[model samples]
Target: MRERIVVTGAAGFIGSNLCKMLLQEGYSVVAIDNLLAGTLENLPEGVDFKKVDVCDSDFSRYVEGAIAVFHLAARNCLDDCAKNPVDTARINVMGTANVLQACVEYKVPHVIYSDTSAEYEGINMFPSKIDSVKPMSIYACSKRSGALMAEGFKNYYGLNISTVRYFNVYGPAQDWRRVIPPVMSAFTIKLLQGESPFIYGTGEKRRDFIHVDDINRFHLMLIREKLIQGGTYNLGSGEDYSILEIFEKIESEICSGIKPIFKPELSGEAFRTLADISETCKTGWTPQVTLEAGIKSFVAYTRERLRLG
Candidate 1:
């Protein structure tokens, strides 16, 4: 009678890591991903995995009899989504709606939906509050639309759902295959190869980073504690660092003399992101990993991956 859980986007970075943690905790896991941006190499062992897009209306069958569902699939590149708003909405919005519909239909008792701090892109306020959101870009709009869809299910169907807005999440197994890879991964990949990576913008844009391990800890809490199941939590370290600062941390580990090249700022990205995690803090969860530790591990992991391949 081990509770089975279904995870969308299981082959992606966060999804794969979450699956690993769930398996270690003895939960029966079912995973789904489209493989468009995710890879099987990131897919965890000891789970029921399916190659399917969340947008597929028939995707509901995957949710049958699960104790809970974790929906993490999305068309989630800000710059890319800005360029392709239609596809962005179709996947981030409609696909989320489709998954919630399945959870409702299949009688799944709970769901955990992954949101983003990008919802606060338009606001100039420091330590952005979860409730004071003002999403500006089409990408942010799409993510917000998905949350609205989930809200509808909560109101009408009485479905238990926990939503979380993640700040800049980093660690090993991050989605390096992204059209525009995450800053940490992109930099590490290039630096590991003795190449100077381009630093988009002036490297002064600040970001609140939370390690994937910390996020997974929160995810476990959402599953075990009913108190964590009904509200949106901001997953961040409550501290902000500039892009250049993060680069320096990574560089300190490698000591590469290759200076980064500066480039024009990318559109659809926020100037600063700092999370107000007070609400989430009440859940007794705090981000445990340090930036230096996180970056060092990531660098090591990336180096090993490259060496093996």
Candidate 2:
């Protein structure tokens, strides 16, 4: 019999991708999402979707007979968390606790958690690793707290657990407000309208952008192969690109005539982020998409979505 997998945030960008991969691999998937930051249209047809939040869902019912539970649901929006820290905590922290409780009660064989590089805030270090994490924002703090809870559950309840700290993930279905999407969208919108593309704060801030496809592959490979157990690994490409560099790539490809206008930098945004995935590298998983390729793919997706090209 095929092992059943319970995936929270199944309607989300990465979650839907992971669910699709799992289904392709012939695993039965019970996907649950509250549609907070995800859309029902994002998930593939035939997925077992429950329109309930992790905090409110009867998670045990989903985890029952499932061999693994992949917890990916969270508030996810940094700006939203900054605006309403309490609500963010309730959903991210409390919701995670609920999921963990369900996993423990159901005796799920393994749990794979989705953590974030934002958790390592207030640190001035390059190539941040798993051991070095200092959450800065309420969202990051909540995620860190959830990670600790996972650890406790593993130690006390004997639930196998692993967490992956994902760096900047960009691809299709990304929200328009996010950095990459907005940049691409704004540029395309302005270019077709014959206006200058805008840049934020001289556009020097660098970030490690990993394609979501790589992340999806990593989740399936890690869970299926069991290369990691009770450990945390960073999922990134280990390559850093600046905001200016990304803009330049997009403009050069789509609209070379238009220049970029500078704007003040946004507060609370990470100035730089680089992931050192040496731990996951040992497991033979590395990001395959280059930043240039990723930017092009995002531009193409956005163009099609907006009917700009």
Candidate 3:
């Protein structure tokens, strides 16, 4: 039998993509999601998909006989998390604890926790290193709570866990239906429809955007090599671009001739984010996708999706 891998939030953007990658690599994927923010359409075929919430008491049964578990389920929208902090905590914190407990009980060999660079919100430093983190928003704080739970499992239960902090990941199947969507998806979708995209704040905030494919490359490496056990890593392009810069790049590809509409900035977000990937690079995984190429391909994908709809 092929090695089995369990993925939480397996219908969401990154989870869905990761499931596809694991399936391609000959692993039997058991996907779990509640469809709260994820859609059934996003899930790929051949997965033993269960419409289950992470916090469900019976969630442990899915972890049985799995070699690894990727805990990606979380309430991650900044605005939504800010407004519904209680719900966010219930999902990101309590839910994560439940998942870790299941992993511990089942003696899963390895566990991968999906973290975010938003942990650097209160810091002013460039090229954010993994050691220092000061999360300011509800979303970040809840995720930090989850990370702490994972740490506890690693320390007390000896659960081998690796935490990966991602910075502005984007690609096809990116969530475009959120109350406040990611900039890349929002801009691409609006431009494809000949409408003006909204730019929250001054459009000057700098962000480190890494393609989803590059992220999955690093993920596959971690699973296959098990290079750094119980380590925290940053996955990013190690480069920062302003919001306007990203808009220009996307507009250049689409030639939409539509300018963005300025709006008040969203609260509880960092002004800038850049990843320090030196340690991650030592693991022999470097980002393979270029921003230019990634954006161009993403534009084409968005156009095709719009055309189909």
Candidate 1 per-residue lDDT over residues 243-277, each given as its tens digit: 99988888889888778999888877889999999
TM-score, every prediction: 0.98, 0.92, 0.99
TM accuracy, model 1? 0.98
* Superposition error at 231 for model 1 (Å): 0.6
* Stretch of 10 with least lDDT, candidate 1: 171-180
Better of 1 and 2 by TM-score: 1
| Ranking 1 against 2 by lDDT, winner | 1
Cα displacement (angstroms), candidate 1, residue 92, comes to 1.1
Candidate 2 local distance difference test against the native: 0.82
Give the worst 10-residue stretch by lDDT in candidate 3: 221-230
Measured by C-alpha RMSD in angstroms, how accurate is candidate 1? 1.0
For candidate 2, the C-alpha RMSD (Å) to the true structure equals 2.3
Location of the lowest summed lDDT over 10 successive residues in candidate 2: 176-185
All candidates: CA RMSD (Å): 1.0, 2.3, 0.8
How accurate locally is residue 134 in candidate 2, as Cα lDDT from 0 to 100? 85
